[model samples]
Target: MKRFQKAAGQWLPKMAKLRGVTAAVVASVALSGCGVVNHMVYKTTGDVLQGFSRNHTVPYLLNTDDLAMGCAMSEATTPLLMSFGRVTNEPDQIAVMLYLSAAGCADEQAREHELTGLAALGDMDGDAAEDAMIRQKRAHALAAKRYFRSWQHHNAYYGEPGTGECPDFDDDLDEFIYMAGLLSGLQALNAEIQSTSAIGVPKNVGSMVGRATSCLDNEKWWGAPMALRATIWAMIPGAMPEGENAFERLEMSDRQGEQAGVRLSHVFHAISAMNKGDNERLRDVIRRHAESIEETPSNEDWAFVDAMSTQLIVAISDRMWVENNGHRTPLGQLGTFWDDEQEDVETMDLDDLL
Candidate 1:
């Protein structure tokens, strides 16, 4: 009986160890299964978000004419949308638009601050002007950073600009995104210059984007590609091609844009004119934009793009008005200047009627 008891005790301890080993294996599998389930859930969710954003949200935003609403959406949702990058491939195309729109908001704020500084200087309030200038710089710096972020995403998706062959775009939307990316790079450089401090925007971005515009068909894109290249040529010393006149090309591009009802090329023309201190040319460009939008109506498929052009043109007009008149362009007077000649109107003769 003692021998039997000894054998039974040894068997019982072995069984206990065996049970513990089985329990550990089961627990490990359960934990591993949870991890697999989590990865699948996250990946699925990311895919859905990415698909919806690219297919639906982007198209809806592009169709609308409300820049303020678009800007708000960009600012509010960028973080949430971008966070999905942790679980899946980053939605670099959407990132380009989000950052670009957000940058526009910053750029607008910077322009307002610049006007405020100008007004303060006009008042001879040196301290106030300096303060406004500081604020302007900060806003410009923010704009530069956001624009650079967009450029980075652009590079990720389309390959580095000025590098090897252009991307094989899947559709018109892909091509449009490429153009926006180019614009983002150029804007980043401009905003960095305006900030007056090195905001890490590469100086070579101008020349790079200038070359990158060649990848796009200028006519298919409503002349915007050439306008962008021409603007860079005008802005950057020696960037223009041999025998090419930047302003002339800009004028040609302007015609194409006006006819297409996109009118984005006018923004580049105005930028070039403003940069060169050619107020006459700037005014002409703005006036043309005003008349074109009034007569042509924005392209139905790209109304948002047309509206953006108008917004930037009006901002430029406001800057000019504020500089001279200490106020923004008056309502319904975007194309008219304070000093412009008033048109003669036929008046009824009261004495003759009497």
Candidate 2:
């Protein structure tokens, strides 16, 4: 009896401890993985459900705005999509970051293009415009390369937003937004090639930009796609069809944004002026943006994305301001200079510390 009691006493506490630890671990996983599991289940089930509803119910219901959301859901959902992409490496999922990054490349090009344009527009005594134009051309060349990098990814992973039978608004918004950025990238490339023909760069974008239009329903979509079509008509070297004026279309897009109470058209205008290196126009547009927001701050319903964009363009002005005055943008800069804030100290000799 004593021997039996000793064995039970020895094992009972250890068994209880093991049970307690296992329960805690299970609780932690269940709390964290609830979201993960729910997303997988919903996505899997949604795709299965899409098979049945492809012909009738899906198209009419989903077409009001992209993805049938009143506000931008992509801002919130993109992180989740990115995490899933990293784990699965699925083509479509992986394409999300690739496409967005492509947009980022175009954004970068706009900044550099502005700088080159500034150089080009300067009145110099000897070969000033010519020198600046060459640099501008090179700038575009690099922008084109980034655009090409994006295009390669698109060709590999971008699925058409719709099938022959129905529009896939779910995936279409993601794909087409990337396409919008691509069109700008292509136009930037075409311009650079024109400027630097002596370098034997290919000046061919009409076909590529024209071909892109087929995949996107530009008639139904505005903003970036409309800007793209306008660019196609104006810059693609007689690529415009009969009776289509690119400038009119561009103005019409601007008007559309005005009527809609959101001047997304400003971003396009800024990009164009930057390509031309016309600082006056860029500054004017930036001022208009600041004033517009002040006038109707509440109207811009998608606060995060639109605000983030304004911050990016404002950075350009900050860059100029810093160069001329040796100070940063007013109200601090985002992802820019911090050297001023850091304390300057003499480095210790190795012997002093070691």
Candidate 3:
């Protein structure tokens, strides 16, 4: 009996120790695998969700006013500012530091500089506007624009490219530059209209300004160039007949030419609001317009819708720093637009956008 007891005691202790060691090893393995599992999930889901190709085309519809939201108050003012240069160094670093300082984003620094420079340029208080001051103002604005573009580029890359993924250049910025250029050209024309007496200004300058201004002012549903109206209506579907889907209304109008116009307007406004950092308004407008369209069961126009919606979202979010200003800020403390609600209710996906 003593012999049996000794053997049993010895076996029990050894077994217990072995079990403890095995448990420790198992726990260690599981802890190590946790990281691998996490990585796999991130790769499969996160990457797949945002894997869209970088679309780099300018949205066709946004007008100069919308484009200038990032650079100046109106389309008319963009050139006056761009005559100054853009700021373009260490944009990401500048933006983050500015954010940390609670000083707004770096993208806006250019616009602010341009504005102050312009205000300083004419010395709005000066007895007469000197050529040197005008040149200085233009120089400052140009510098600011460069910085604005750099900041925008950096921010876009920071969000999507960090994943070692696709290049995500913003189309809205390109459009803004394009629109700014057009407006600058217009301003020169306007200047000649006022001061250039040595030679008569080209009639085309007067005609272009008149047309561009008309594009900005007209609000009629049927009378204006259908392209402009349709484009505007697309971006802010809320502007359409209250109950009907703007797209459907356009489709039913069977006026393809007009419908195209409305689409162009929508694109332009979406691009404009984007540069201005007006996300709430941008989202609200898209949501309203999206409600009216008949989404398809199969072979949906999802690509186009998704591309436009994504561009709208990205554009607004990209320049969020500009939204918190006196002139650009919404009407009410909790407001969206300067005068009236200007957008529609249609949404697009970031992944599928053009």
Candidate 4:
């Protein structure tokens, strides 16, 4: 009995150590299994969100004519949608649109502040004008940042611009996204210039975007590619091809945009005109845009794009009106100006009716 008891004591510590090691192994495996399950869940959820956003949400948004709503949606949902990149591949394609829309919101705000600054200058309120200018700069900086983000995502999706070859687009949507990216790059540069600060926008973006436009077919895209190239030519000194006329090309592109019911080229035309300080040409572009929208129904599949063009045109008109009249364009009166002559009307005297 004494020998048996002594042997049990000797073996007891080993048994306890064995049990402890076994428990650790089981716990380790269980923790690993939980980790695996968690990863799978996250990956699946990310995939679903990415797919649904690209397949349904994007298409629906593109069809809607509500620019304000779209801007709000982009502002509200960009973070949530972008977070899925942690678990899945980044939705760079959708990111381009979201950032572009968000940038537009900022750009619009900047324009408003600019108008306020102009009004203050007119009132001779130096302090107020200075404050408005500061605010406008801040908004323009924000716009530049957002537009640069869009350009980055476009690079991620399309393997960078000015690569001397176009990406093999899967569909028209892919091509559109590519174009949006090009627009974003150009906008980033423009916004940075407006902010009068180095917002890390590539200085070469103007030339790069100009070269990239060659990838797209000029006629099929409603002359937007050429319009973009021509705008770059007009903005950047010595960028135009020898013997080519940027303004002439812009006029031709404008006609194509008007006929195609897209009218994007008008925005470029107005920008170029405004850059050159040609108010008459700018006003004519705005008037033509107002008339074109009324005359041509927006292409059904691309109504949202057409509406966006109109939104930009309206913004330009508001700036012009505010500068001249201290107010925005009147509702349903976008084409008319304060300086426009009153049309003659046949007036019947009330006494004659009586």
Compare the candidates by lDDT and give the number of the best one.
1
Give the winner by lDDT: 2 or 4.
4
* Candidate 4 deviant stretches above 4 angstroms: 351-354
Query: What lDDT score belongs to each candidate, Candidate 1 first?
Result: 0.93, 0.52, 0.36, 0.91
The better-scoring model by TM-score among 1 and 4 is 4
| Candidate 2 C-alpha lDDT tens digits along 172-279 | 545444564455446445545544534332345445555565566543443546766666565456777899875566566654554444555556666656655777
lDDT of 4 at 192: 96
- CA error at residue 123 for candidate 4, angstroms: 3.1
Candidate 4 deviation (Cα RMSD) = 1.8
lDDT of 4 at 84: 82
Model 2 C-alpha lDDT versus the unseen true structure: 0.52
TM values, all candidates = 0.93, 0.46, 0.26, 0.94
Provide the clash count, candidate 4: 0
Give the Cα error of residue 306 in candidate 1, in Å: 0.9
Residue-level lDDT tens digits of model 4 in 1-354: 999999999999999999999999999999999999998898899889878887788788888888889889999999998998887889899999999999999998998899899889878899999999999999999999999999999999898798667889888888988999999999999899989989899899999999999988889888899999999999999999999999899999999988999999999999999889998999999999999998998877777888999988998898888888888899999888999998999998899878
Question: Taking the tens digit of each residue's C-alpha lDDT, what string does model 1 give over 260-310?
Answer: 999999999999998899989999999999889888988888889999999
Candidate 1: what lDDT?
Answer: 0.93
What is the lDDT for 299 in model 1? Answer: 82
Worst 10 residues of 3 by lDDT: 96-105
Report the number of backbone clashes for model 2.
Answer: 1
